[model samples]
Target: MAAKTWASATRDGGQSITTTSVWSVVRRLIGYECFETDPEYLLLQSIYEDLRLYFNFFQPVLKLIAKEHMDKKVIKRYDGRAIGDHDTAAPPYQQVMAFKDVPFETKARLTNLYVQLNPAHLRTTIDAKVAKLWKISW
Candidate 1:
């Protein structure tokens, strides 16, 4: 996983900077900057798991679903970050339970679909007729 930051200039002369009010940054980046909280945590990714959100969610189920079809180690190598952190390495039971609104069950797969809509899409009318959709072959 790539580690990136919004404001990652804390390292200087191999020492951790406690404050971001350095004269160099004021003259260079923002011209002037002030912060209410520690910019390191806010602007910089201090936690390792910040990048692996979707990978972590799907990691648990991959083993349960794909073990017979694929190698587990190879799957981890592709889907997982180099080092496991609080997010990616966390056990599935608690994380699955943390999901809200929809009913979650132990023996069933939880399928989620997210849609991004424009105002034009909303203006289009719905078809109203309800029917079960099976596989479509053309």
Candidate 2:
């Protein structure tokens, strides 16, 4: 799904999109760290695109470690005021697994993928790829 669409679907009222926040991190890695000058920056469009593809490869693994805060309930007062109560933070994988409507086979597939992931290794790979981009930019 497109990041904006996903964000719109999941975000609470008046809350900022998490995907937008995450994109800033991507921008810092690719834009700020890679290019040093305006002229050089224009020449590195291919590199930027390549690095984006590389980053996306590991993005899901990175998200495996990111905790998402889930709201459990909205408590309504006599005056019609409502407050959201959050549940414990969990990774997206766990949240999917916790869903009653998710099919058992689908959950099993996710579990299989989850077991093969190592967050430390994924981070190292992302760092190495970003460093590679830095090298190519110069």
Give the C-alpha miss distance for residue 32 in model 2, angstroms: 4.8
Segments in model 1 whose C-alpha atoms lie over 4 Å from true places? 1-37, 45-49, 57-110, 113-138
Q: Residue 22 lDDT in model 1?
A: 28
Best by lDDT: 2
Residue-wise C-alpha lDDT for candidate 2, range 1-138, written one tens digit per residue: 213222265556543322333456467665544344544443344334444444443343212223334597434432122223333444557657768999999988877866776666656665766666576666
Which residue pairs of candidate 1 clash? none
lDDT tens per residue, model 1, 13-124? 4433223322342224222323224443233222212212322333353222222225455333322432233324442433565657547554144323112323233222
Most accurate candidate by TM-score: 2
Model 2 Cα shift for residue 93 (angstroms): 0.9
Per-model TM-score, in order, reads 0.18, 0.46
